[model samples]
Target: MDKDLEHRFITQLEKHQNIVHKVCRIYTSGQDEHNDLFQEITIQLWKAFPKFRGESKFSTWMYRVALNTAITLYRKSKKSVRGDHYEHVLNNLKYNEYNDEEEQQLKLMYDAIKQLSDVEKALIFLYLEDRSYKEISETLGITEVNARVKMNRIKSKLRTILNP
Candidate 1:
C-alpha cells in the first residue's frame, strides 16, 4: 500500500512537474534558488499527498501547494535574490521558434512578469497556463469575482511595465 501510494505520487508529479518548474522560475532569480525552491515544493507536495482526496485536479492542487511553498519560504528567507541568470533558464524554457522581434517581445514580457508581486505572479502564471478564473480563485483562495478583478489589474500592471 505504501509503495502504491508512492507510485501514484511519483506518476502524478512526473506528469505535472512543469507546473512546479514554472512556479519556481517565477519566484526565483537564479539557478540555485530555483533548484532549492523546486525541492521544497516537491517535499511539500509529498507531505500533502496522502490527504489529497481528489477534490481538485492534481495540477490545481499542485498550484496551491507550490504557490504556498514558494510564499512561505520567500517570506521566511532573509537572503536577497542576486545575479539575474536569465540566459540559462530562458534557453531551457524556450518552446516555439520566433523571429528576432518576437524574441525581444517575449524577453520584455518575462522581464515585466518578474517585476510583479508574488500573488500577482502566481495569477499571471496560472492565467498563462490557460487555467480558468474558477481554478485561479480556488488555487489562490480568492473569489471568482476577485480573481477577475485582480487579473484585470495584473494586465494593466504588465502593460505599464512593458510600455514604460
Candidate 2:
C-alpha cells in the first residue's frame, strides 16, 4: 500500500478497533482464537480497503468487513482440530474486575449465546449492537424481512436459554 493509503487505513482502523474487538468477543470463546480472528479481520479489511467508496459511513463499511471476516474465520476454524479446545480454554479464562452479580450475568449471557447456531448468533450480535434491520440485511445479504425474522427467533431462543 502507498504511504497515503496506509496512513488513512491506520487512522480508520484506530477509530474502529473497538468494533472489531466486540465482534471478536462475541464470535470466539477462546482468547487465542479471538486474537487470531481480530488479526484476520484486520487483514481482510486492508485487502478490501480499495473497494470502499465514501458513500457509506465508515462504521457501516466496517461492520460488513468485520462480519464477513468473522463468519469466514468461524467456518474455517470449525474444520480445525483446535476448534474443540475452546470449551476448555473458555472455562479457564479469567476476568479481573466485574462485580460478582454482573460477572455472573455476563457469563450466563455468553453461555446462552454460545448455544446458538452461527447464523443466529450473528443476528443476535448485530441486534445487540443496535444495527438497523436494513443494515443487518445488507451486511448479511439477507432480506430485511429475513433479518427481522431471524432476530425474533434469536431473541426467543435466547429467552429459552436464559430462562431454562
Candidate 3:
C-alpha cells in the first residue's frame, strides 16, 4: 500500500482499536488468546482494507471484520476457555469506586455472558455498545427484525443464567 493509504489505515485503526479490543474481550479467555485474536483481526482487517468500498461507516465495517474474525477463530480453538477469564477494565484498574456487591454483580453478569455462544456474544456486545438494530443487523448481515428478536432472546437467556 502507498504511504497515503497506509497512513489512512493506521489512523482509522488507531481511532477504532477499542472495537477490536472489545471483540477480543468477548471471544478470548486470557491475555495470550486475546493478543493472538487481536493480531489475527488486525491482519484480516489489513488484508480486507484494500477492498473496502466505503459504503458503510468505518466503525461499522471494523466491527463486522473484528467480530467475524473473532467468532471464526474462537470456534476453531478446540481447547478454548470460551471467554471464561474475560475481565472488564474497571476491575483491573482497581477503581474501588464500586462496592463489593456491585463487583459481585458485575462478575455474575460477565459469567452469564461467557456462557453464550460466539454469535450470541457478538450480538449482545453490539447491543450493549448502543448500536441500533439496523446497524447491528448490518454488521451481522441479518435483518432488523431478526436483530431485535435475537436480542430479546439473548436478554432472556442471560436472565435465566443469572437468575437460575
List model 2 lDDT by residue over 1-164, tens digit each.
27677667777877777778777777887767776676667777777787889777788789888887787777776433233423432233232221235435577787788888877777787788898998888777899999998888888888998988
Greater TM-score among 2 and 3 belongs to: 3
Query: How would you encode candidate 3's per-residue C-alpha lDDT over 1-164 as one tens digit per residue?
Result: 27666667777877788788777767765667776676677777777888999999999999999998887776777333333222322112221121234335456666788899888998999998899999999999999999899999999999999788
Q: Judging by lDDT, tell me the better candidate of 1 and 2.
A: 1
TM-score of 1: 0.81
Model 3 stretches with alpha carbons more than 4 Å out = 78-106
User: Each prediction's TM-score against the native?
Assistant: 0.81, 0.79, 0.81
Against the reference, the lDDT scores of all candidates come to 0.79, 0.73, 0.76
For residues 8-121, what per-residue lDDT tens digits would candidate 1 score against the true structure?
Answer: 887787778888877887787766887777767777787789999999999999999999889878978734333243223323332322123433545667788989988998
Evaluate model 3: give its lDDT: 0.76
Where is the poorest 10-residue window by lDDT in model 2?
89-98
For model 2, the stretches where C-alpha displacement exceeds 4 angstroms are 78-105
Can you list the residue pairs that collide in candidate 3? none
- Candidate 1, superposed: residue stretches over 4 Å from native: 78-105
